[model samples]
Target: MPNWGEWAALAGGVPVTEERDPARDAARIEQLDPAYHHHDPSVPERIWDWIGEQLDKALGSVGVPASGISTVLLFVLVLVVLAGLLWWRLGAPRRAAGRAVALFGSGGPAGADEHRAAAAGHAAAGRWTEAVREQLRALIRGLEERTLLDVRPGRTADEAAAEAGRVLPEHAEALRRAARTFDDVVYGEHTADAGAYQALLDLDRAVTASRPTLAGSTS
Candidate 1:
């Protein structure tokens, strides 16, 4: 019921009435107001906390330890950092070819050895398009040096392949294919890869070793 005195009064003829404080009720409403709730987080805080919660739920489902989750997050952050560093060092991967003109550009005429060296460098750097172009250049230049094909100014890839094919009849098809790859990378607005580069390199070696036969010769 109540304390001894209150119980005694209740047992007697006295009645008790509950009292309300209007000031206290107004203060409670003020405490619940959003603008006055300084302890609550802002929008950015809510977003960041939501991301962390999602990550925890995902990783926890895989039975990752709470500490291990941090480690995994740090590892992913490191990979992203390393990618940024690589882009800074080697530049971004291009969707289009280099801005140079096709087939030897405007530079002075380079020897077969020079072109081959350039192709090797590009291959090492994972620039397959440039590598393929340079290797094809080396193939044509080497044949010219060997007197298997004439070195004519302003000669195109198709013309060079046709002329060389006539002299090196056994490799005519290969030479034509190599020329097409060269044109695709350099002028036809296409890309190349490691396999294409390797093909051109093999063609160059084969053409260098083979003896040239005159056009229409049975030999």
Candidate 2:
């Protein structure tokens, strides 16, 4: 068979080093086929050429190993997964968490038109809870897209309000009050009527117009 150092170097686009260990590559060849050891020199050359082709293809699909692009890609994937997990564990705001939830949907959470249709469905069915839930969800989604507030259901209202306040201290009290109202209607024992719904709609609009800061606020 071919010299392991030459083959590995050809595959890796590196020079064969005299001090390099060849036993590992040799063992790999042995696993492929123990009979390969008996092959002629031409056979080993062809095999190395094939390995070179494969490495070339792998490199093209990604990039040169110089940038550690493959390693960085793996690291990025791991970081994305970890970030998603952290958002989940920390009870990211409804808006923030929806990003993860959207992954479960066929084409992601329904678009605005779809949401409107769903809201209409809830309204037609007279399912106040469902209608309110849908509206609240839409509001949260809009806020997130606009970078107004990073709301998530897993996060408490106080936490969300605090975040909103930090992002827009000028509207902090208003945000806090709105959050309190939302909590009361959505989770409290009180029944939310048309007036409450209107109030929520108003709050959503106000928050949208606030031109709030980014989620990462110093306060």
Candidate 3:
């Protein structure tokens, strides 16, 4: 696997807390299949070599040994955090961006495109309630990403429509209707249908193509 440390090191180094241990790297490599740990300079070997070099450099910067298990663990945690931030930047769960606790009791996608994909998957599987919910999530996230609406954490579907309505008044009624559909499937425990999902999907496409009116301006 690539170390990914080179890119991570661009963030700069901190004080190292551990010393290099020769046996450590060998032990880790040993844990993997010997078929993959060979000395051949084949493509895979080259890739592994590059990863090793990058890791060594990053470890050197922070005075942490490449074999420093504790430092490696810390790097894993930092990587996870960076991943979460990237997810947020891409319009995923804004720490519950889709809304109330029940809105995401089973978790959700990590971005607008992802939500749309999930919605499609559900629709294909004949899961209309799930499809409607995910489609609406895509709409909300897409709006937020385009700056049509502020990225408000914990905002409900209705709040999202109401707020977005101020800027896209032409779509106000449609947005409200869409929000109600979302609330019905998500909170009202109502079942949805292909028609409902299609309606939300159509609205999502329309809103994506429609330009939001500038603040204090008329369309």
lDDT of each: 0.82, 0.59, 0.79
Count of clashing residue pairs in every prediction: 0, 6, 0
Candidate 2, 59: how far from true, in Å?
Answer: 91
* Segments in model 1 whose C-alpha atoms lie over 4 Å from true places: 1-102, 215-218
Q: What is the lDDT of residue 149 in candidate 1?
A: 72
Distance from true location, Cα of 9 in model 3, Å: 99
Q: Per-residue lDDT of 28-93 in model 3, one digit per residue for the tens?
A: 877697776576488987897887778778777988765784568678989999998776444344
Better of 1 and 3 by lDDT: 1
Encode model 1's per-residue lDDT on 21-139: one tens digit a residue.
Answer: 99999999898898886878989999989998899999999999877888998999999999988765443444223432345566743899999999999999999988898899899
Error of 2 at 168 (Å): 3.1
- The 10-residue segment of model 2 with minimum total lDDT is 97-106
Which consecutive 10 residues in model 3 have the weakest lDDT in total? 97-106
Error of 3 at 39 (Å): 99
Q: What is the overall TM-score of model 3 with all chains considered together?
A: 0.51
**Tens digit per residue, CA lDDT, model 2, 1-219:** 758868887999987556756898888877788476566568789997786667667876876663564575678689999998876544436444333232112343444335545655776777655555455555556656665554344555556657767766776776566555555445433455665555556665676677666556554
